[model samples]
Target: MDPVIVVGAGPVGLTLSLALAAQGVPSVLLDEGPGTEEPRPARTVVLREDSADLMGRLGCRELDRVGLRWSGWRSIRRKQLVRNVPLSGGGGAEDDTALTGLLPAPLHVPQHELSAALRAAVDKAPLVQRVPLSRIDTLEQDPDGITVHTREPGSTWWRGSYLVGCDGARSTVRKLLDIRFPGRTAVERHAVAALRAELPWPDEAVLHRQPPWRTGGAEVSARPLPNGVWRLDWLLPPRGELVTPEALITRIRDTLAGWCGETPAYELLDTGVHTLHHRLARRWRKQRAFLAGDAAHLLGAVGTQGLDEGIRDAENLAWKLAHVWHHGPAEHLLDSYQAERRAAVAARLRAADQSLPILRGGGGLRTLVPGAARGHDTLLSDGHLGCGALGAPPSYSHSPLAPPHTEAHAAVGTPPGAPVADVTVTAPDGTTTRLRERLGQGHPLVVLVAPGTGVWDRRHWQTAGVMPRLTDAVAALPGSTELLVTESYPGASAHTVLLVRPDGHLVAAFGGVRPAELFTAARTALGGAPHEAREPVEPGDGESGGDGDGPDTGRGQGSRARVHADGSAGLH
Candidate 1:
């Protein structure tokens, strides 16, 4: 089997590799070293709810079993506890409450912990081969496939069909492709320090933002980590002097010193000086090569959105690789990688670029008046904390991968960071369960929580309201299914049904249960045509009784594919 070479054993590469492996696709993964698990930088990364299912599917145990979740984050001032801004939604779409329930609180884990989890998960994937201490010296791609040459400080030879660049901001692959990276660097350097401490803060994540006293503007946000530790990050003025580990630590100690009278002992875990750079590669793909995560885009650290965005990139690209390698042409899909992602990065950087000034210290949540609307609340948005802007849904706007839409307003709500809410349901046993748990990864899913009455026949599901192309796709599915019941959200009048993809974001939705509407939705949910208005499956049988994925699913033998270390390529 020809292997796809994945550069960087970090989250993005490992994740895409795992997705491919899960589906029997294989590939090889290369990284500079085991990559230290030192938990160094001391940065806290919040994994958006949307990326959770994808990561869990990749087999990260922290995502599956041990990660910490915060229902939402609370904002605070020097003295007062401001508003508690909800992070993830309450499970907005009405699908199986099972999957929706999983959309509960957002997960907050350290970058290292996350790395450790990805490392473990990838090790178990049969199709993934982990090659540590190895680096790619050069890459050359042609009509047939790609040839990757890898070496360590010392080394040998290896070949592959494709390469996914997950290297950091200074990406060698991006350079190899000659993709230009255009963006600016923040003039104000930041001091980020992680130290063990006991602060008077909530167990949930806290961002105590403040305006820079001298600058009359910039702001700083301090986050608490898992152990009895905390991270203090603040913007320094253009003329601000340089600071070492001790000096930065002392400054933090003195600043928060008065607040916490009995200063808890703080041992500096790690400290670093980094200037935030906002840039996106000129392109994301060239021939058989692709870039994801930090390798593709870099945004100032305003909302801790970098990692989650990368994880989403992997999931999106993984399936595209799977489908093309297993069934169609590869070139047809590569263009979409840049078309879809470049726009996303541009938008994120724009927002980050705008918000950076507020950090140098004036407006924004950092300047919210204490007694004033501590938080300006509205029914439509979540935090408005610049997060909503970055959490902006992903778009396949210019890509052929997404079917063309005729609607005047092309709705794009299913991308990586869109937030969702939760709902209740009448389970198979006539009991209630949540939607989150039901959001199993890998399966193209249709979640129908809206209550509909007419016996949904195939035609009812077809022309009633389904979008032409989407309906066709769903209808052709092997056993595309739906979950039906009453209200997904309490007190909400109209029943909203959303067609969700394998990951937990909405693909299509309609608020009413109009007969014609329900049919269109079912067809849309199924991806189209056959009008599969099949009777709903009984409780506990989420699995469609295909040739057999049941009590006896594997059949006479397990179907398998020959895969390399990086999860790419499949040989039947």
Candidate 2:
């Protein structure tokens, strides 16, 4: 099988390659620059709870240990505390009850650190073939495969089943595909500097805004990074003003003094000026070539939406690509990538656009009267601030991959397109575990049985006349599937069976045992044609059935599921 070609070796591309490798798919990673050991200049990047969870699952465990976790941001206007926006909609990070059963808190890690972690994981992945200093000079795609030629003379063209462009803002892949990026670049630029200083509030970000009468209309935000490093970003004056090193230092000192009551001694680590853009590609896909990360969308630097969104883009596309590669040609599965992600990126861009004015020090009446900006505040509260707080990620309810929602499934609270909550569940052996621990781990498709108030016995399921059919239906599917029988699923009714996709979105949710419906949904989701089922087998009847205690590691104890490092399952 041809390897999937990944352009750009940044966090997003590396993440995509790792995610695919987890699904037992091989990918060739390409980057134009030579690999560097020295960490890039510090830049603030907050990983949302989901992104953090994904990174952990993909083997970037060092992030949680090294990255600082923040609960929220404190907005101060002219030395007066305005609002303390919580990250998880609770009091603060210390409030465990408010965060109970939720994904981990948002992490404040520099982009370099994140890239380093992901790159490390990629280096360890045998399925990934990393090619450094290889620039794509041309891209050509045929009906079956994609070919990318590097700029290096005498170099052979790289071949892959599909190509994804994770290259940054000025993407050569998007340009080669002739996809139009439509959006305006903000005239207002911001100076971001990384400093080594001790901050009083080390766990929370602080945003300070001063009226034009004081500090020359300053708007700055300081977020604590790992160690004593703090990332400071402040809006730059319109073009005419010459910004010298001395002037920048004076501004930084004044801002720190205003926040800390005194200018604490600090060493400037790095500084750069960045122009924000709100651009998004008109198309995310053309044939076997696709766009992700900054290649696909470019939101203003208001909340670090681009980074998190790009990571999500990688996750969303990885599983589908794996499914299609392992199973067969599933056009709908691949097409849904753009359908779902494009809409999500568009929404985030809109939210970023709404929040840009305030971050740019144009809050106006909204700043003075907080109630006047209730709508904008709603966006912030809804996890639009910094990294998406513990709030819900984008929903794909409208996507073609999502089954049509009905009132019953809606009442269950696990909607067809909504992300499955990482609720804790009890195994039949009384072992407790989070739902996410098993859902998308080694299987692209998972059948979660929530026998609410019902016994965990297979006899009960057989008596209800759903076990045999369910088992047979799943057995007939193209790829590996996991059947998890838990004591109860929160927010779902008795005998509830949830068919989940690899990205944690529900393909379908049944309130009660409906084997035929589940079978149809599974086929539709996998983009497989109707196939005859083998003879019905009860639990423990064959190698397919489990020991009736919990989720059965299908086939055998040695068989790999969806995202295993062994690459035993789903690798064509």
Candidate 3:
């Protein structure tokens, strides 16, 4: 069996490859170029605290090294400061899940620097095979596997059990599969420039606009970069007008002059114009082929959320594929990929839509700017910092994969179906650590036993059959870990068990329930084989087999026992 094939070597593809590697799954990463070129014009991105935490877990810390931890943003009109707000709720008092100083607020990182960090990490990952200068021409998928047709000379075909299209907006895979991408593109074009200049501006990002808001006037944003440079994003009129290199520079100077008393000395580093778009794929998955990142959806650059959403997609899909490939889960488990991520993208898109209008000046409603800024604290705490909109955290309560929770669980901290709140957890040895730090190891399932819960025993569970069955199931799952805790949990009993999914979202919280009922819920969450096979095959263990390869390798081989003709061999 060929390795999982990941198309496009951008941040999304790189993240998925690394996530898969963490699960001991090998993957082939392909891109159009040598995969060393930096993104042009130095696109700056703003990552929310949650996104930063995810990257930190993925071992891509270099981004923080070359990025600025931006704390606040200010909006200016007619050379007057209208609204100024910090990105995070001071002291993180707005939300229970907020990790005060543990996590930084939204930070601005240049796109090229971020890509460089991810590329460096990819170079060190043993399981990721980087195939540079390779472009996917087309692909064909059958019930067994997928064969990728590339443009490589004399090597047109590459095979893999799964293919993910991380390719950007104009995705070949999505087009080949005939998936509909429905959304409108903004009539106006956005001009972005990286510059080294002496400007009279604060370190915080400044959104400046001229009067006559109804007509398309000068609306530009300037942000200080960590690398001692500045980035400016200018919005042009809807009418098409060709802007030359000198014209672009003059536009920048004039926009600055309108803000400050006079234009400051500046040296433009790079610049470009791009049209904004808002598009979402009709479907994210089709059999063994799937779409992620910009290939699945496209949002405006108003909030710089396109990259963050793409990374989240990679995190969500990687483990599901690993489970099916290594543990023989029913392929239907992949359905949750679409069910969960599509909802997230929808929420992000809505947030982006809401921000775009405000970003475009809101038809001269400048007075409301102060009011919006006042309410931004709640918006930022709700995890909408990425898109700069007042939004709520994603709710997976309706997710098919998330186990149903009770009323009591709903009233607890970090309600079921929401991302697990980051809390301090103490071990029996007196070692204290954050729950996220313990979960950073990337386990597919983590069953957290509350503090004061006595030594692990099946009899401890009030639900009899459930404990035994769940123990057996968890043991069979390759990347599952059972963590006994001595940390106090709000709204949880001593015997409460919290089942956390790979993406760190609470699926079920049960204090007391029948064993059969919980067991059924666990099976439903697993979604694959009814039960895992007990037989284990060591790669070096003496066993007659084809190719003399062990279960650890052997293309398409799983850790489970072989299915016999009598159907009595494997648990599935």
Candidate 4:
């Protein structure tokens, strides 16, 4: 089969491959750098919960294994710790099945570590092809697919079906497509480095945004690293004097000399100076060619949104691309990928830019800025950032897979992209879990509501037996799938159960009344096969399933099938 080809080995590119790999999408990945991948300790870590789950889905659960689970944040001004806030609270609508709906708290793990773990995770993923140093040279795209020519500088050309440029800010794909990246370069260059040592972390990430360039711009933040290491970043204005790494390090030591000794025999792992610029690509896709991660958009350096946005870009596009590859969605559907994602990136850029004032110590407007402004400045970028708005259960107002809003949601289910109420999630294995558990597992959960309202009462569900059968199958299967059935979820009727993909998209929500109609519509919307030869629903936010409610509206539970059809199979 012709596979989707991704270029870049960075966190976004690698994690994108992992998301596709999880959904069984065959992909070829090319990264033109480094041999071994390991978390560089401190390097820009994505600071969002969705990013963690996306990384986890990419097979980087190793982060939780090696990285520290940091909580809350602390901000300092002139060495005085001022703002201190927690990332989440285990409160609200806590119940027997699950707990507090969700608080958008991010997890911290180095990009290097996340990338390495993703590569390792692909070991079981035959669809993901890793080609390090396999650089791209030529590219061609047509309606059918893409042809990507790659080489080793002056070597033979290797081709691929589709070309995805996740090649970072200086993406060859962007250069090749001649896509315009428009943005202003920051007045100062950002210097990043991590030191390994034991220091009192205050159990939080600390940030210090120095005053503006009047006295020469310089700002720093303190984020915890695994194994007692501390990650520090500096934003320095160019002094017209080319500064060496040694000189820069000496300056940092001078500024932080007090804490330097406390860190023990600290070893500096990696160091690099990058000229930070705020660039946004004119477009993200052309024909069968597309851009992902940093290739499509450049996030300003005011917040922790850069990598998170890239990962979201990958997850959002992967499933849509797979749907097109499998069932041939409308070409316009494919076009929407760039539109929706670019808009999201745009939102991040605006917020990050708006927050820059705080990083520049309010830029002579300290008293003028609202507390929310400064709060967002000091916290959102530096803390285990909360994205209750977009972090968990983010929806696509225009997802091609989602059915055209009937009455535009004239009124059922939570708002698209909205989080569900907090409740317990119980498994037959006797494990009672929390809301975050479903999202963090990296595997999608097919939630089957207990059944209510005549919304699912149509002929579509009953005639096809699609809804009931799938749930029953999932229930019988031991560990391959997780089936969440709840009767009393807050804000939802007893019979309303929602199917949540591991990536946090709402796949199929029931209880509107025309049971079968909903079943059929949902199955069709998500690219699920009919029950005639139905395969188990494939989670991972990829195409895919099922049944029932207790009502005259035509819903019922699945009778236990003594015979197992777990061996059933289907085609692409």
lDDT of 3 by residue, 1-572 (tens): 56899999988999899888877788999887777865664477766666667777777876666776654576666556766656553222233334343223565788877778878888899999888888888789998889988886525688898999999999988998899999878735777788877666545666665533332256667777765577887777655686688877777777656555577777778898877788999999998999999999986544446777788789888878886787664666788889988987786777766655555444455545666643433343333244333333355777777654534242456677777766665432435556665543344433443443233332233232223333333343333444434334566654455666767777677653223334444555656433432333322322212222111111111112122434333322
Candidate 1 lDDT score relative to the true structure: 0.55
Distance (Å) between predicted and true CA of 181, model 4? 1.9
Query: Candidate 2: worst 10 consecutive residues by lDDT?
Result: 552-561
TM-score of 1: 0.72
* Candidate 4 structure quality by residue, lDDT tens digits, 1-572: 47888888777777667777656668888778754664455465754655665565455666766565555576655545567655452111112322433244456667666666766886567878787677788887765667776675535444555668899888999999989988766634667777765555544676665533232135676677656666776766644456687876764565455444322456787776756566789989887778987788765465545677787788777766665555544465467678768876676566556655554554565656667446654444442354433233345555544544443132234554444444454443334455445553333454544433224433433323234444443443312335554434555653344655444666555553233434444443444433422334432231123233333111222222122235442211
Decreasing lDDT order of the candidates: 2, 3, 4, 1
Runs in model 1 lying further than 4 Å from the true structure = 63-67, 77-82, 86-104, 152-154, 211-218, 358-386, 392-400, 404-443, 450-475, 478-498, 509-572
**Against the hidden reference, what TM-scores do the models get?**
0.72, 0.83, 0.77, 0.74
State the TM-score for model 4.
0.74
Order of models, best TM-score first: 2, 3, 4, 1
lDDT of 4: 0.57
C-alpha displacement of 100 in model 1, angstroms? 12
Clash count for candidate 1 is 51
Question: TM-score for model 3?
Answer: 0.77
State the RMSD for candidate 1. 9.3
**Tens-digit lDDT string for candidate 1 (1-572):** 47778888877777778877765678888876765567664565666655765676566745423345553465655556665654333212223324443324556567777788888888877788998888777888877678767775747666777789998888888888888888776644677777777766644556554532322124455555555566666666655667766677566766466446644676778777767667788878887889999899876455536777788788767756765565446464556567766777777777656654544344566545663334322111232223455554454434443322323112333331232344454332334455444444333443333333123332333222322222233333333232423334432323334444444444444433223433343333223432434332222222122131111111101111223335342322
TM-score-better candidate, 2 vs 3:
2
